[model samples]
Target: MYVSLNRNTSKWVVKKFEENHNHVLHLPEHSHLLKSHRMVSEAQAINIDIAADIGLSLKASHDLLSAQAGGKECLGFTREDQKNYLRTRRQRSLKFGESGALLGYFRNQAAQNPYFYYAVQLDKEDMITNIFWADHEMITDYALFGDSISFDTTFRTNKEYRPFALFAGFNHFRMTCIFGAALLYDETVESFEWLFKTFLHAMSGKKPITKGKRMQDNGTLIEPLNQTTEHLLSPKYSRSIIRID
Candidate 1:
């Protein structure tokens, strides 16, 4: 199932940082990053059913995105088989080629499991849209296929973007997104949210961090129900009004 979002309807969706300006650092090359997260770290198929799970319609999704990005989705909610590879991912969890082995981790997995096809397509927006095949047997043909990635951009020549990271964790497994945040000095939630949602995946850990402001004007004087990220990864570090879904 494909969900399409047009301009100014649903207020939840945010473009993947790299999809727009590169916010979350989600890939293996930058896996060394200690703070952020990404989704497409490696080539994989996009789970489009995500929208259905989230109670979204193709039109509703299109509207949400169009509103969030303030643009029109030319190809709204369309499902087509286009090959895309995964891009960004988490820092601590990523495992690279074992080296010296004729068969690799991806190969073995492809040989065994059929849930995640090796050959997949990721849009410039970092969303998976296609796969080599929908089921197991057909995908085996691509398990050992040479990886091909398309890193697109000419706008970088201008100083409008910088690299950033967006991350989230589930159970014990963390996945980063590729095509992440802008590599710049000052950070913005717009960029962060983008990278955050790519690997945002399915059900998550906890509530999203909210705006830096408190509930009361003299709120600082009173005990608070929530906090921020200071010495730890708590709620206090968040600067936005509330976390974007």
Candidate 2:
């Protein structure tokens, strides 16, 4: 196709239009791969966000959507496209800096639900060293099933390489219930101490009768666990055990 500017009429006119293709055209089955045909719809975008929030990998989310849509050919977008979308969305979210955005999100949550609780631990330089949060559901769950709990912090899968900690327990039916969660800058004893203290405060000073935690060979968590046990139990409840796995 070709167009020319017509100075007399100040309008563009088609000078040449070729009806025949110069090269082999894409087959119908492959047409969906074309740039013009590829797009992530609003509904699909929402599903992607849901999947990401639930910790689904890009490939897994894409495959699930593909299956839902009957097949990849009908999914309207590629996995790379989904990844690019998430990358751009994350970049946009950090426009005000990651810490600012995180605090803003927490503020919004607290505004919507008074039971939402969160705490940020800072260093001498006033930079965030760790963060902990638990919603109303988690708080209520803790009150009901906080007798025995497990804490884990081995996850460091995000881009920042921060340790993601989760405080969880089982309900009466043996279903897992989350009491709280945190992101730590390091695995040091100080970080764990602050996290445990904040968690106890958030749960209204309710202590688990039996606490379970994974043991790290570095021995950094030993001091924190010992200190936490002293504060977590009364003289009569001293039999509470700190199970190490």
Candidate 3:
């Protein structure tokens, strides 16, 4: 999914080392920092909300995401662009060895700058969803009066391999996702359709906060979910919606 939430959340497991004199005997040589060269889900020993409380800024990033172009609920991806991006990433993944050192290096950067976050939530049935966030855009962009935001979402083929992400776009800036539906990724799109439909269905089930019974007749409601695309090199937040427990 590789939805670069933020530099910290991405490498939270152990990028560098900072220690106190706990004096707990036998702390391993690499104990203070991350050791494994493996990719892990966001839920691996980290809590998104707690990480936010400690100044890890995923929520802020999510907020900075633009809903300016949000019009309809599900503006899916253009097949050509998406197919190409994945093909390119896949080619790169193969060259570098899907699970190799380059990836590990990205996993251990230790600078404190404005970064983003993608939270992964789970349920008793162990279903999962992802949320993309950034502290805020590094730049300030204003929408003109009467400017509208286009909310768009894109679903790709099932994860036949390791790389799987859900993408949302605002305009030029897009959020690349890494987590959603958890193990649902393992299933073919045909089989896991129930999950995909459920997400699309989220927009179909909005609880109208203002108009009473306006959406009752259809028994369905949807809100615009805009994906803001930016020019900065900030990472993508194209994952699934954040489904809370």
CA lDDT of each candidate? 0.29, 0.75, 0.28
Scored against the true structure, residue 160 in model 3 reaches a CA lDDT of 26
* Each model's Cα RMSD: 24.2, 14.2, 24.1
lDDT tens digits by residue: candidate 1, 54-152: 646446654554464344332222222111111221110112221112125446765777453333333465433222212243222222220211111
Any runs in candidate 2 off by more than 4 Å, and if so which?
1-97, 211-217, 224-245
Write the residue-wise lDDT of candidate 2 on 130-233 in tens digits. 77899999999999998877677656746544578788878999998999988776677677678887898999988776634334424533444443543222
Worst 10 residues of 3 by lDDT: 138-147
**Which ranges of candidate 1 are over 4 A from the true structure?**
1-121, 124-191, 204-206, 209-243
Question: After best superposition, candidate 3 residue 190: deviation in angstroms?
Answer: 20
Could you estimate the TM-score for every candidate?
Answer: 0.18, 0.52, 0.22
- In model 3, which runs have C-alpha deviations exceeding 4 angstroms? 1-111, 125-127, 135-147, 157-245
Q: Between candidates 1 and 2, which one is better according to TM-score?
A: 2
Q: Candidates ranked by TM-score, best first?
A: 2, 3, 1
lDDT (Cα) of model 3: 0.28
Give the distance in Å from residue 165's predicted Cα in candidate 2 to where it truly belongs.
Answer: 0.4
